[model samples]
Target: MTQTVGSRALSSPRELTRVADRSSFIYLERCIVHRDANAITAEDAEGTTHIPAATIGTLLLGPGTRITHQAMSVLGECGAAVAWVGENAVRYYAGGRALTRSSALAEAQAVAWANQRTRLDVARAMYRLRFPDEDPSGLTRRGLLGREGDRVKDCYRKNSERTGVRWRKRQYVPGDFTAGDTVNQAITAAAQCMYGITHAVVAALGCSPALGFVHSGHELSFVLDVADLYKTEIGIPLAFDIAAESDEDPGPRTRRALRDRIHQLGLLDRCVTDIKSLLLPSGTQASEITVADSDIDRVSLQSDHDQLLPSGTNYGDEAGW
Candidate 1:
């Protein structure tokens, strides 16, 4: 049977490429993106590039990019996230879906977030992950923030010394990308890319992006939290390197450099593992998790007995009628 785009069968969670295996993200600008069967075709002045829809963790649509409805439909079916971003990824507009059918991770995140003690514990855990030598258990949220600021300052200083880039304060004016110096511009670009990548991983894991432990009041607060974990280690150094080279097109160069580094380091896999470990119970191995174990298309009804009932069955006594 011949099926139209609308009538085509969707790929199950197991059938789609795992988050770890997929490219962290594909950043496209000045191109028209449309679906050709299961592949995405990006048409630009250079040429058309064919991309497998299922192998994408996120489709980052930058400035001047237009996408068709069919492309969006296929991306959604494959559980690939789509994010609309600004040039140099400085502005993040909107995003797409959660990749899991099970509510396990989302429920776990809520449970941890809903309580003050557990929430603090999670925040401390995050800090510990970011700064292994530092103990965050005794610190209040304010103290944690202070420690983080101190470390970031040190990181900036060290990177400046390492890269020979002029040491200056991190200057970023919202809505103005050109306000900062070359280094600052690169830093902003790297940070934004990290956010986009982490957002995709968070969504793919089916966790709530709003329920954050450290960062608060934003829809992508949790995403920001996760992305910061790698900022000092990955983003700062890369940004410094980019700034050290030349001032020409810092945004694009930073994105390209960051993308290569992320793929080389397999940051996507580590991101998945880290998020799962943080949200899941203690002693749980995040690496062992898989979408198939969660069972795509599996649905159940909650009952009073603390058990799940099979869905799609009539519960009435006169069922045969």
Candidate 2:
């Protein structure tokens, strides 16, 4: 195998820019995921299903789900992230094995983040994506924040109008799920779900979640930045629609709706693509090759020395024997 190929999988996020999602998602419960020959398989009460780890962004393991070390290794090699959740995948407890070791993406991210102009360009690109068809030129960072806030308020009002729900503005109290209105609660639940998905994608791409362009001052600043890109389009609208319903608790419904929207939007795959675009706007950044060409030349020279002489030459027959 070529040294680059035998590294044996890509260890750099830049190399993963074009990687496609295998299944988009794999949520398993009451099952065990393990290695079956060269493939990853999940065994449950019903049967065993093959999991294409390489293309999957995240594996959600609910209550009763177990994974083997070998399977974890396979998922890591595939650059997939694992999330440990509660029953029905409602609560995210902790993260499991996520395969990534490249410093290239992280370093590139830092370089942009450290520069004022480059970071502003990235932030502007993100804003342009969020509000397409609108030019963000001549807008300062503070001006962007004001515009973003106005748009968010406008989103709530628009969703309320579309869903026939009363809009009073977004309100949520951390650690107190019931403190917020039904719409706020639903939005909170949906946002959490979105964060889980974003976290998985960010980790898989070998990027630091701590570094961010728009949002800052938090460990998950970048996660929040990516998550917010779709909230107005997905979470807010879904929450309002759920709130218009008669259920006393709409968290479950909102979550189901979010999952449906995620698939409908092809979000898992988009997440990977969007992250790459954000970190490296010009496209995938190049990673420096670690193995030296001299090493390869030395190996080729040694192979030539070890080979016996061919038998066709006049002096070769005696040496060949």
Best by lDDT: 1
- What is the per-residue lDDT of model 1 for residues 1-321, given as tens digits with 9 covering 90 to 100? 333433335566665637888888788889999998887889999998888787888788888999999999878877788878776545555566667666778888999999999999999999999999998878998999999999999999999999899977989988889999999999999998888888888888888889999999999999999999999999999999999999989999998998899999999989988888888888766544453554547678787667788999887774453
lDDT of 1 at 67: 96
TM-scores vs. true structure, each candidate? 0.90, 0.70
What's the true lDDT of residue 301 in model 1? 79
| lDDT by residue for model 2 (211-313), tens | 8899999888888889898988888888888898865767667766777788888887777667667776473544331112121211111115556543335
Alpha-carbon error at 270 in model 1, in Å? 0.2
Clashes of 1: 0
Question: Candidate 2: worst 10 consecutive residues by lDDT?
Answer: 289-298
Give the lDDT of residue 171 in candidate 2: 77
Best by TM-score: 1
